[model samples]
Target: MEKEQKKNKKPAFVAVKGIYEIMPAEFPWWDRFLEVAEGVSKFYNFERIETGIVENADLFLRSAGGEGTDVHKEMFFIKSNKDKWVLRPEATASVARAYIEYGFSRLQQPVKLFYFGPMFRHENPQAGRYREFRQFGVEIIGGENDPVFDAQAISLASRILKEIGFKDVVVEVNSIGCRVCQPAIKKKIQKYYRTNIKKVCRDCQTRIDVNPFRVFDCKREECQEVKKAAPVFLDLVCSNCQKHLKDVLEYLEELSISYELNNNLVRGLDYYDRTVFEIFVEAGSKGEKKEENASKLAVGGGGRYDYLIEMIGGRPTAGVGFSFGVERIIEIMKKKEIKIPAQKNKYKSVFFVHVGEVAKKRSLKLVEELRKNGVGVIEGLSKDSFAKQLKMADKGGAEVAVILGQREVFEESVIIKNLKTGIQETVPVEKMAEEVKRHIK
Candidate 1:
């Protein structure tokens, strides 16, 4: 009966499906990505901002294109006593909400903000995709609808990727037109898809009526031909949008940023208008053999959302921003085998080895004191064997070892040993930290 009860005990659990753990071995890659992202953001004069993960469900439902879109279908709802809330599917909408709720508009014309955090969406996971993924994003909001801000936003995204080992990024840009011209463009897209409606996917068939722009975003093979032949909005945008797009392109050229004029690059979100862009890189980068059908991965993208602020209850505001999927970017870095620079220590690092209970009791204090003097130290206090402690020190790459046995502890002296040369010397306990520093150096 006791054995049966033991057998019935539950097994150890694991992380939820599609959730990934950032193990210690993978931290260097993450560090490099975040370092470049944050550095570039600050260099570009953008302030950092973080918003709560849980926000009102209606916040996204209203601004993220309502029902039927991928975001709408993939949200994870949270039970609450008050209004419905959800884990944010993206950051831009939350940033916009913060801009309005915090009254950021009262201070400046356009508030520039950047963020790095996790976003949630309940979707089928694949390589480089997860139920919860991290994003490094930026937002430019509240200013006049100047096109230069659009170019600057794009430039910032491009610079960060390039600095973080992505040398072959191509910016695929397009103009989806504003309210003034979208209606006509929509009609043209709808009419084109209507004739080929039977050939397209069921989703595209529905989108053609609900939002014809989204049909351009379909990946269905059946809809490819239909979408390719659909009307191009670039040719039909109003005079204002045309000039805006032209100005943004010229700024990009002036900055020497490479870009392609994509005719079918309407973004997935509903808030974007006037300018939309996506950054893509070939899978064969870093001298890898190129395949004829090597599909490009979109590391990041965003667009101008002039009406997003007003749409979400704030006064009229123009905003343009972009976000990079941290996982996708890191995946590309690993594929390229990009090396992260090793962390440098000005002072040499040493290992602390102690034997006997008395020395072990004194080991912690010595380690802390050495640290206070700018000496890097690794210690094995729980390790009772002197030989094992030294082995651990060598494995940790420590340059020197500080030995403290019971006799040395009582005598007020310690042994300083060079790990590489195997040289040894006895020093006063007060000078042990300094002696180790000197030898390691």
Candidate 2:
């Protein structure tokens, strides 16, 4: 009875909630997107860099701007020995930490780098939003605080989305100024909110005194109405901040990239200063209703974070970067029915087939030889029947199948059959790899 009970028990094992697996069928779309991103990075002269998935908790606490930020609250913390480490909720802080630890300052100024990896955040999952997701980002560090870099970063992001088939994309830009001008704007914002405190949400009321800039980012209906009447940062900025933004706009115009100036477009992150922008795509034809709905679908965003490196123990360095959620981009591609061609080689694929024991042994040697010669090869050597093996080769998308049977083994030769043209020829064992190549062409 006890044994029967044990046998009837159901095992409890399943994938964690909010995390997903990328199956083989969907890899083509991912590959195409990454290819375009890599090409864009190369064209812009940005080198690739990678940092650890786990980092010191204090690194984010200090560099990402204190305890009030969303990035801080969403961090997944783990204790290691006496220290606390967190799964990186974002890469900017990790990259900044790497810059300081590796002494990148001694090298050339404006070290451009890009990264493609996964980031973790403990948040409720939704469509295109996962607790663990992949990100592709680029950063320019150690440069002079030039507005040109800001425009360049935005231009690169816009170009990438365009190349990936997002036709109706727009960049919304704003400037919150630096330490020199932000205090005046903050004071004005505080005074404005204090008068209408009861009208705003509880969260916004709490955040008003702590971080007034974030009040512009509130999405609630009640708070948004209050925000519309608040003081705009553009009018309150100092002369330098004004000129910096104007120059960025001029450069963007020269590049032929479309942009919209928004006074209330403050990013949620605390490190952002001077210039901030978000990339949004239109769902359909441009109209009042469609435009209003499209603005909510922000595909990607980033801005200048000049003070971030200094906060993490590095010298005062200027930096700018942007990151896009890979899953979100893929979701858009599917919704738009964008087709991606199968990523096959320029050379035709050669499938290997064998009949009988001796040919099976020899087929292994031929596959290795073909692979070593840089030939794309596929095979079904386990099947004993020749007809079934050939069927698999056709289904596997092979252009040609190389068959080795008892007769061919005795003659010390092999038969190469072109699946497309139904042509067959026998070649010497020593010349099989070369002959296969010739037939594939």
TM-score to native of every candidate shown: 0.94, 0.93
Q: Could you tell me how far off, in angstroms, the CA of residue 342 lies in candidate 2 after the best superposition?
A: 3.4
Q: In model 1, which range of ten residues has the least summed lDDT?
A: 1-10
Error of 1 at 274 (Å): 1.0
Clashing pairs in 2: none
List the candidate 1 regions with Cα displacement exceeding 4 Å: 1-11, 285-287, 291-295, 345-348
Collision count for each candidate, in order: 0, 0
Compared with the true structure, what per-residue lDDT tens digits does model 1 show for residues 1-441?
122346777547756889867878788899999989999999999999999999888899889778766778899888755778899999999999999999998977789999999999899988768999999999999879999999999999999988877767789999999999999999988888888878999889898888788888888888888777778888899999999999999999999999999898988889999999998866565776777538578899999999888888888888999998889888888888877877655767888999999999998999899999999888988889988898898789987888999999999998998888888999999998777778876
Location of the lowest summed lDDT over 10 successive residues in candidate 2: 285-294
Q: What's model 1's TM-score?
A: 0.94
- Tens digits of lDDT, candidate 2, 253-305: 99989899888898877888899999887645233355555445688899999
Where does candidate 1 clash, by residue pair?
Answer: none
Cα deviation of 385, candidate 1, in Å: 1.7
lDDT for residue 122 in candidate 2, whole number 0-100 = 85
